[model samples]
Target: MRSLIRILTTVKELRWYYWGIIICSLLTAGTALLTPFIIKEATDEVVASLQGRGGGLSVVIWLAVALLLADLANTIISNVGGYLGDVMAARLRTRLSQLYFHKLLTLPQRYYDTALTGTVISRLNRSITETTQFLQSASNNFFPMLLTLVASLAITAWYSPWISLMLLVVFPTYMWLTTLTSKKWQKLEGEKNTHVDIAGGRFAEVIGQIRVVKSFVQEKRELASFSRHFDATVGLTRTQSRYWHSMDAARRGAMNLIFFGIHALIFVRTIQGVFTVGVMVLLIQLVNLAKQPATMMSYLVDTAQRAIAGSKDYFEVMAEAQEREGLADPVVGARKQLAPGQPMIEFREATFGYEDGDNVVRGVSFDIAQGERVAFVGESGGGKTTLVSLLLGLYQLRSGQVRVAGHDITETPAELLRGSVGVVFQDASLFSGTVRENIAYANPDATDEQIERAAREANAHDFIMGFEHGYDTLIGERGLKLSGGQKQRIAVARAMLKDAPILVLDEATSALDSKSERLVQQGLDRLMQGRTSVIIAHRLSTIASVDRIVTLRDGKVDEIGTPEELAQTGGIYAELLALQSGSKRDRKKLKDFDITA
Candidate 1:
């Protein structure tokens, strides 16, 4: 396939290994050819004259020794080829993993929003694994089998032209049958893989929402649905396996027919004195050599399909439209932030969307002074998240630009932008590692004192030290062992350690109880000192202290002013505030008489 060819071209760097393994494999085939000659000579020359000739015994002994040496040589060659194949496989796998990792990091954020998490994980894990497996076989087994077939046919023709011609007749037929079957199976395999992906996606979704399922008491229904989907996947795999096994069986039967017919013709010729016994014996070896290539037809066909599939998947990942970086035509730095003064951020008429004509944030404009604190507020589906995403340079603007300090985000190098911005999402995630490692992730080289200071600034130090292992305590996957508030605090600590001048907090306090929220707010106040902060929150009270408030509607700015100014205007913001205030009052009144008593 075109995809397969592209993947093969990408691996041109491994050509040396390919050649090395090819040489060893061909040498092994040569040893196999020598096998027939040794057998034929031992039979006719040694056994026939043993009753009379004195030199017969010694000839027989040398011939036997030669056979042993040839077999040993073949074994050594095959082993060497296998070693080379394995080494090449390991190298390719490492390169692939690194490529996928880098690709995932560099792709635009919209890609993540659209693709399923499990599908990506499976592609990176199983898809690449399948490709590597096929590569190993292609080098070690497939090439050797082809060489054996060619060498055996040439040698057969030298001994008996008629038999060689017959083999040639069967070879093309065998190849045709194998190729047709492989093509069919290749199509089936693609379908099977799709079903597998669906099953994986469903399984992952269920695991992720286990809490909801439990709350709804829908365990029985969930289990039944999962079983049905899993069974469907199994059915597809079973069909593929049956087809593959049947193809192999048919190929084997065809091979046996050709093998027997060749031997019969050769034996009949020997009876008519047209061939010597020694040559007849040699013919037998030649016939087997001829069959060696055809016998491996099924395996080769399967390997080819796997290689094609693997390459297709590899290129699918590669074919993703990569994010383009700004050119270096004009040497002027578009944005600069590392100066000794305050760092300011400005969005000049910025507009953006994941796709064309679907603007999620249109004509947005804002400016944060050196150390000003601003908060974004709106109802669900507002552009608060999109705006924050743009500020972090995860998504490029359709029109206008964002400047960090004084540099345009697009023109600033990716690494430089990442180093300058720190963000903590509403749902905090941490990798499986020690508490200390998670806190110090942003500043890996930070000393213990520095790490503790950052944690204190995020109000995470007290609870972390209370653990049995203190900073050494391990957090499970995604920091599942830690509570929501704990995770947020650790995330804040990480951001603090980075010491970036710009911070974006997305509902960072939503997960905390009142007591924890108060403690974290104190630490946040400390961290926000002298830095530009962008806060996104549903609870307007949380952003009451900010210098300015920006309310979004649909995908555009609906209002921008101080909290007091927005409330006095009796607009959308005022109505929402009054509704929340009245709801809170009613809840308090439900228990008001108890305080008087």
Candidate 2:
């Protein structure tokens, strides 16, 4: 209930619309209440005329017209209320979606490390949708129902306190019955949501990686797993539905018994001459009007439960700690000036790891002067990428500090730090968009001339022009329409456009054929000019020209020197160099150092 109220309050800007809905609902209820009185007057006139002591047919005709106008008014007003409700609901959805998306953007990278993409998407869609629907329904149905119940009871009590008392009895009784089942129903709904989210997550995963699944011939296995999750939801639904309906049946039965007694009392009193036939008719109609809310109670409860469950999920994500970087104002196109003799980039005793895992990088320290090209080379899982991630401030270090441009990254905003660095990874990570858009992603404000210049520098211009649409050509998701080399070149073009002071290339050429590697490396070499460059490479040949090489072993720096110096040190770099050279003497020497080739 608190979550539901919080969601409602989130759209306070739409309060005027809410007020309009309430006013319209009250008017609709007013028209409905007027009908019974109007009909009663008409009936009483007819009765008096039959007894030859009435005003005439004129009175009845006027009353009938008034009733018609009232019905018409009710229809118009109720439709207006529904319109307001719908507009408010849509706007609320827009606001809530924006908030959720903003929260997602601000969340630390660590949160995403364990969260599945599909699950995250599923929760956002389901929770916001459910919340919007409930709010709309409350504005449209719940408000009007409450208005009708209150007005009906007031008029009824004026006519007969006993009948009003009986009508009031149904509300608390029905609510109590609903309350009994609500917690249980919500529990079951939450359980079902877990299965649904998992299924949805898997569904998206399978679709995204369909090629891999097909290659492995695991389509049946994936489908079975998806079906099993939904099947569990079905079983939960069966139990939940049975429980809810059984309780609804009991509540409805109770309502019927109470209304049955009320009807009998009205008939008895009219027959006893304690009330006129017209009065009896009015009382019966009011009782029926009061019964509408009772009938809708079960549906309202169901919607409320779903909304509550979804709101809990929504708020859970919102409650997560957002990145401190997100709190700072964006520092766009504003590079912090470095002092003289300061390293362009520095890592001092930096130690870091993923959530609750052994440290991937420990006590690692390094410094890079401006315009120096350095490379990190080691076996896989040597913390080469981790070191770069720390430098980028993607994850907070467990200890020590990383500084860029002489500013401690812990104190500086990540946006400001990242704005100074350009990165190109092994995978291109292109979006499904135009050739122009992918390159401009690094710098959204880059002009067509600038974009083309970057592409030309990356050697992607000729191939891009080969497409019928040229720069405007739509790349499929993750640039699937392009070859591996094409994607890598486009990624290079993106980083080139960034034109940051620092550049990091993580195995950027490792995934390419020799010809492709040569093209990408040429582009990379041009991109690295006059920048502090950090290269992570598995292919030793690529780093032969770097000013220095840092070799990592077990998350610690084993050696740091120029390529020539490291080639003679007989360390990890030397061992790798020797293995790549395929020299039998170096291989025999590696055994003396207890190193496996």
lDDT of each: 0.77, 0.88
Best candidate, lDDT-wise?
2
Model 2: residues with Cα > 4 Å off, grouped in runs? 326-336, 583-597
Error of 2 at 450 (Å): 0.9
lDDT of 1 by residue, 1-597 (tens): 565455556678878987898889889889988988888888787647965653667888999999999999999999999999999889888877788878887787778877777777767777788878877877777778778878878888887777888788777777677676777777877876666666676677778778888999988997787677667768876887798888778767777787788899888999988877888988887777667667776766676776677667767777786665654222123124345553477788888877755888878887777677898876566688888888877888889888887777788766677677778877887989999999888889999999999999899999999899999999987898998888888988988898887778888787678787777777777878877789886455678799888877777788888888999887556656666567665435423111100
Top candidate when judged by TM-score against the true structure? 2
- Cα displacement (Å) at residue 12, model 1: 4.3
Q: Indicate the TM-score of model 1.
A: 0.89
Candidate 2 has its poorest 10 consecutive residues by lDDT at 326-335
Please list the residue runs of candidate 1 whose C-alpha ends up more than 4 Å from where it truly belongs after superposition: 1-8, 47-54, 237-254, 325-343, 580-597
lDDT of 1: 0.77
Instruction: Write model 2 residue lDDT over 1-597, tens digit each, in one string.
Output: 999889878778988998899899999899989999998998889999999989998888899899999999999999999999999999999999999999998888889888888999999999999989998998888889789989999999998999999999999999999999998999999999999899888888889999999999999999999999999999999999999999999999999999999999999999999889899999999999999888988888899899999999999999998866635433333235665777887889999989999998989998888789999876568788889888887899999998777777878777777888899999999999899999999789999999999999999999999999999999999999999999999999999999988899988987789899889988998999977899987466788889998888889998999988988999887777667568787565544321233
